[model samples]
Target: MPSCLTCIARKVKCDAPDSLSDCGNCRRLGEECRRHNPVPMVVSRQESKQFTRAGTKRRRSQISCLDCRKHKRKCNGELPCARCIRMKRECEYDTSHGKEGTFHHSYSVQAPVLSSIQTSPSQTSHTSSSAAGYQSGSVNSPYFQSDTSTQDLDPLAMFAKQCPLFPEKELMKSLVQQFFARIAPCRLFGFLHEPTFMMKIDQGYGGRFDEFLLLAAICAAATKVNHEANKQMWESGVEWARYVLQQLILDLNRISVTKLMTLVVLHEHEYRIGNQSSCFLITGLCTRYTHILQLNVEYDNDILCQNSSLTASEKESRRRLMWCCYVMDSFASSGVTHLQLIQENKIEIQLPMSDEHFLFERAIVTDLTPDTIDHRAYLVRLMSIRNRILNYVKRFDKDRDLWDPQSEYHSLLSSLQEWCNIIPENWNLNHTTIYARKSQGLLSPLIELWIFFHLCYLDLYRVVVPGLSPAMRPEIDAVQIAAPTDFLQSSQEACFNHAVKLTRLLEASIQHEKDGPLDDPNIIIGAHEAIRALVSYAKVASSRINDDTKQLLAELVDISVHHLRLTQKRIPTAILGLRRTVSIIKNSGLAYLNYTNLESDSDSDSSQERPGLEEQLNPLSQFSVAARGLSERHGKGTSSARVGSECSSSQKSMFDDDNLLSPGRDMFPTSLEGWLTSNQFGDFI
Candidate 1:
């Protein structure tokens, strides 16, 4: 019997089974067990031809690539074979060179394969055989080690090691359900489809990395329900989110709607954690990526009208994502008028439809134009109004060539009033039924919409607000040299009245939140801004106002302050900023009264530089300076500066005889009259 090539090469005894084509040794080793003919002499061309005709046909080359050979594994004998592709390594076959059994030197660049020819076991050393996949010291590589391979580098496996048991298929499903039920009901989070999202999650770890990132984000958002049971889930969700982010960076560069939505989720998470700066940065990325994906553009129905074209779901998804992006970009960059990211006019996409229509991707709700709109449409309208308001405010900036407040103020006010007049019956602020709906969660979106509307309303007219504009900070060189003032009594009264309505709404919202889920950071911060505005108005107008007006402002301030102090723990950063501004105003108010009294009384030193009426009445002037210093101090680090940092010992000492609201102390003013007076005073004391 002819011995197999491998047995002959090793000089081992041939062991065969009569029933099997392959020899016993070769079969057991999973090697290509072909028989070899004995060497024959070639006397002449005619004799050689006769000998070749008589010889049996040898089997085709069945040898594996160099990598498989080194690992003692099976390989399909193709150039750049399956194993090479999976391992992400170069594949090379052995080629004949100058002599028999000699390989081309260049073949070593990729791990060179061994020739299929026979060789003695003594001649082929184990070191040389094993070195097929390596150079000197290459064994130190993790890939070269037996335990670690390309599979070990999988992000899912790495993520599994970090976040075990969480997002374990069933748990992830439940969390996703919770997200849709709780958070997704909000218009801002309506970007993803329930069925599609669930189907992707069903793909498990084998699914797209972007899908996993989205699921992780959903998990994080769902866990925001503020229950003790959800604490572990929140932490696990955060871990998984981090894992997804790490994996996303390593994965393909394809930017999909899923990635944009994931970023939005992460942005909200940052905002929830009071990381406004991070939120702004992430929103910018989301906006840029959204624009790149052309989600901001309307679906080309002319091209996509065919059967295989973009489906209703796809179009709706694009619209939803685009709208959400617009909302977030507008929301995050709302206060900083010049920093807005999305250009509203550049977007030509349709606003998202009703949740029912969008969710099922059905055309059942064909009456797109309506006198009264749904919550989603109402929100889009509000965003439009907000966009207009922001644009109007942008014109007030001194750097803008269009800085003409007198020309624009009436038109802007008219537009805002038109918006208020056109509010749908369902969204009417005065309707008790609407309040009932809000309590029942039927009008949940309106709660935020109202707050956002008021926030924008406040921002629009704040430039002309009486106490803060021309009369407030006239002494500061920057204030004087900065934007030109356009103080109007109508803008002033309108601003204060809006502040009153907003503060009332905020107080009610906070009180309502006592039994509901935790307030979002937006609501908290919006409320904080309202409080700051109210207190500033009161602080500036207190000395020149009547006792009744003083009491009214005082009540508003107290309620806002009470709600703020109650919810400060959940949103310490936001609460802390407002607290600092309030503390500064209070301290500065006290300083103003003391300085005035010092100048008036006979016991005072004549040489002392008494503060003028501007400083005495408008303590915000000093507060602004100290606040700038505080921002400079805190801007250097990630950790929060104390609320008292807004008013330093040096700042407070300028007003009060002592450090009234230092880090460890509460901001309780000793005298309401000293800190915040109600009675009107003449130009002279």
Candidate 2:
């Protein structure tokens, strides 16, 4: 008796009385019982040897078909095996040894062009020796060797095989060139070295999944530039690149410098599409990778001691990547203290060198504190200052250092002033400076740096002006400590001035779109903020101001609105800003009814009723008596120390009264959570 095939396959006991009967296991499973004859154990030596040889030959003749071998299934030694016939797969077999007849299909396989550069035995031995020498101190030795072996496998072939939807090689080369020409010069893509990356593309991608992902990301970013002639090409490129990158991310199992660059590029893409939640999560992942790679510190330091094979350009690229991560975190957090991850004190890497030095692979030692003002380095420094300003504003409710000379507020204001005072003549926004930077491929980043400087000022001063700072509106209205009227007026004035400045810069950037590409979509955020401040001020003061001032404000608002509309075609988030601006203007109850039409109507009767309109629209008019009383109370104090403590209780009661009747509550949010959940900017998550 022998075990039935079903029981054998299931690895269960047959439990049958004899070979003629059905096995209990097969009966329970409701399958047919089939068995093979058992070998006799009492055979002579010659017969046993003959039986063993025949069994060996039978097993050799029953080689599994290719499809069955792939899925680890048993084959029944037929031309088209049972599993293959049942599953309708092509039955093929390896016949290199001339045992099987032949493969069912014949195909010509050509070796890749890069396979000619395969390392010889001597070269391989030398590489192994070099890798061994650095294994004692270098943490990246294994990665370096892995990259070398991957290069030997011909990356271009691997990429083509894995991603069948990739564009042809020539078109891909054009896209790569376009990326470097337009998008790489921006601060977000600064981590990619053009010469090094282009060389890798010309040769091969080293069969590294991360590098393939990086190529897809670059193509995706390049397609975002507005080009009418290649509109179809751009759309297809974006779609294909996005699909390939998503697949690569799912298959990703390790991290490297190229992978980090890929994630940075993807973050920018996500932001452009108004997917801020994805951008936030990606930022967190990038921060973790930065810590894992120890990118915050110099690679050559004792802790890392990178291998000698790492080039100067490679090290500089990693440094630029570290700074880019910090910048991404800063922008994504957008002044929220809890969301921020990168701390300024923990960053020990040096600032990036100038574009010239980086492009030519020049190894220059730029200290942590740069002496010369490189635009990229200056941008990092400004973001560091911005983080401080945002944190200070976030804690404004409980901060007791108002009007103190040594307060963090004063220090941040002084930093902004100093930044403006030290501006280099070369960095001016004239035609000559713009063209010069454009020729050198530095225009976009320089313009972004300039825009961020004004934005920083807006963020710091907009809190005092009602309906300007959405996140801090509740704190502004609920805080008990009464700020000086002079200080308050000055802050409001500063907000208006900076808003105008930022609007003008945005207009210039849009005007110069033909001179060079300015594809950074976050500039729209600046435009939206500028629009809020300008619109708020115009609603309150347009009636009281002279005709010339009124016309100027009208022109600025029109320009800002126009820019926001233009951005909406490329960035989906800009539509939110445009809608909010329209609602604000409509609710103000002024005669400037048409959003598209900003001109005043000469025959409208609203002009005759202008005298009392100011009182109705002014947010601060009802609080005038309380403000004056607080001023008098402070004036009666003999010592400066007594002013803050003595006015606390009275100021609290006054603010409480104002909060109840505040007219700006409709114009602005009353709480942070309410603002985020409101329809205006609620889609951020």
Tens-digit per-residue lDDT, 1-685, candidate 1: 7676667766798777642477777767666666754545445533342233223222233556777788887776544446665665545455443556634111111111211111111111221211011111100111211111222233334334334345555766787887776567575677676775566445443333344456667777676655344566656655655554554443324565666777788876656555555565677888888778887786675323355355566676667778888888776554234446678888876667766666666632223344313566667767777666655553354433223445565566666677667666656776584467666564546666677677767766545553333223332234334435443434455667777887887676665664332345555545555655665566655555677776676677666666655555444434544544355345435322212211111211211122322212112122222232234332221111221134445434433324444566545434546433521121212
Off by over 4 Å in 1: 1-165, 195-206, 227-231, 302-308, 335-338, 364-373, 394-406, 430-442, 466-487, 514-518, 569-573, 588-685
Model 2 pairs whose backbones collide: none
TM-score of model number 1: 0.61
Evaluated at residue 279, the lDDT of candidate 1 is 64
Residue ranges of candidate 2 with Cα displaced over 4 Å? 1-154, 204-206, 227-231, 302-309, 367-373, 472-474, 478-481, 516-518, 540-544, 590-685
Error of 2 at 257 (Å): 1.6
- lDDT by residue (1-685, candidate 2, tens digit) is 6787667756788789998999887687666677853444425533442333212112223366677888988886454456655664445554442654332321111123111111111121121211101111101110111112322234455455445356767778888887787776676467777876677567544333344556777777676665344667656655655654554354344556656777788777666655555676788888887888788988775322244465666677788889999988887666655456887799997788777777776676674333433677777878889888876776665666456677677788999888766666677667898778877777777778778898888777655666565432456654324677667666667778888888887778778765443366767667767767776666645555666666676677677777767776555455655665655555556554346544322322221222211111111111211222232322233222232235455433332323535765443334667745753321343
Estimate the TM-score of every prediction: 0.61, 0.64
Top TM-score hit:
2
- Top model by lDDT, which number? 2
Q: What is the lDDT of residue 370 in candidate 1?
A: 43
